[model samples]
Target: MAEMVGIAFAFSYIGDAFHGSQIQPEVRTVQKDLQIAFHKAKFAGSNPLLRFSSRTDAGVTARMNVAVCVVKKSVWQKMGDLRFRRALNDHLKDVVVWAAEETSEDWNPRMASRRVYRFRLETMRQFNKPHDEGKLLEMMKLFEGTHDFTGYCRPEEGRITTRTVDYCKPWSIDGRLVGFEIAAQSFLWNQVRRIAWAMSEVALGTSSIEVIQEALGKGEQPPFFGLGPSKWLTLWAIEYEDISFTDKSGDFFENLSAPPVGINGRQFEIWQQSADHEQKQLLLNSWLSYL
Candidate 1:
């Protein structure tokens, strides 16, 4: 019978595989693949739908990205079956459909209470030597509270360009690399990558915290600055409050049939990409040298 089941899957998609994350009739995407697999398995059609919490850039990777989809009870019941797991693995190999499970039918990946993202830095891309990551972390002082991240993203976003960052600080994953973990209820397109660029600016004495805040306060488009290769930004994790889960699965799901329409998110990512290319490449080169 038809039922709303919150199924979350953690996976990876090589940046080169498709034309970004959303499904387009003219192109392929992670969403398209998920839909295909479900369609082939007979669990998706008009009744069940899949939704993602965040959309990473074409070349970006995720360490803890999340998505939820409703599927037939029969498919949900078979989630633990070894063969089913293997079958999914076979179809999703390089894309990595690593985990799947039941969640509240009302689950929304975007509405999560908090999201943690890690920007992994690989030092010395050319000579392969590790630099003093400590020197690179002082810029983090500028990220501690709510600020207008407009300087870190594009101006074409259909919705409000301002956002609040719960916490952001830089740290060393090991002596080899320095990374920054940013936790926020939500982020704008290219926000994290650009902030990384600001950090790089600080390290080089090309800029300062005042510069960063001045930009944020002024709502300027992030100075054509973006960070290392998309590979470095990973969606570390997405968390939800336990109270958001409910026993009334059917009713809760029924309420999810239509997501609000007028306010469109993801509108600025397209423009942000063009400007990010050079910014990311410059940082990648410098970042590679850090190792």
Candidate 2:
């Protein structure tokens, strides 16, 4: 049996590099490039094969994404020892495979571990205005532990609604919008997007905690269809206890210096000014509609 190799990438290469995460006949994709590189490198002097854990949308991103491939240990060492970042950039710069890690013949990226994601939202409209960060935190507290997130996500990551969410809560990010982190064994497609929309509604007082709580069920009349664009959700990390994220996923600036707080403030103000004055009045009155 051929040995399996696990690969990881940053999500920034979505629509620009390929059509999306999914591999299609007419377009380029992350997985395709990896396989292409392997073949081009003649890692085994044969066509290279690879697989991704989850297929992301056109614009989606990953901080610690994962992919798997198989090759002989000799070829694995040759490719693994190669300076992947410079090599890939020099030869196959189109798709930046900055890192690579070797795994046993039986390794599986998706089934062996959990995933972590971080999402940030900037209140760009009300740049300098103060937000009730405490209220946002309080509402997010409601997401902790196991709960039905069916209302907030698309039905593609998985069909089962009973997910044991290890972490769900919001924290301040720069003075703009709240940032939330989620860690779980896995996720369904668009799950984070749908949750972000619901959480944002709650923050703006447009929806209640009960609305989110009530929507957790997978029964008839599930949660609201996802809101907002899919650009904001970033797959921050993928885990497989069996495989060391560091060894398999490669280096992710996990310890970067603090982000620009000023940029967030400016973006927040911009987002606020973009809001309609009349619409604000209607939103104020319709606040009760969330009930």
Candidate achieving the largest lDDT = 1
**lDDT, candidate 1, 1-291, per-residue tens:** 467667766554555465667777877787777666666655445434778878877667554456777666666786553443445555552354545667777767777898777764432131122234455665565666777776786555476877777877764433333457788888878778777767666555566667777787787754547655565576666767742222111111111111122322343333234333533444333222212
How do the residues 1-291 of candidate 2 rate in per-residue lDDT, one tens digit apiece?
A: 655444433222433345667667978776666666666666544575566776676655554566766667765566553454444444453344535566665566667467777665443222133345666677666666776655655665547765677887664434434467887887766777666766666666666777666666433223456454544455666666655554434323232223335556656445444432322333233222211
Task: Give per-model TM-scores.
Answer: 0.71, 0.72
lDDT of 2 at 115: 78
Best by TM-score: 2
Once fitted onto the true fold, the runs of candidate 1 whose alpha carbons sit more than 4 angstroms away are 45-48, 81-84, 122-135, 222-224, 243-291
Which stretches in model 2 have alpha-carbon errors above 4 Å? Answer: 1-17, 84-87, 123-131, 156-158, 171-178, 217-224, 246-291
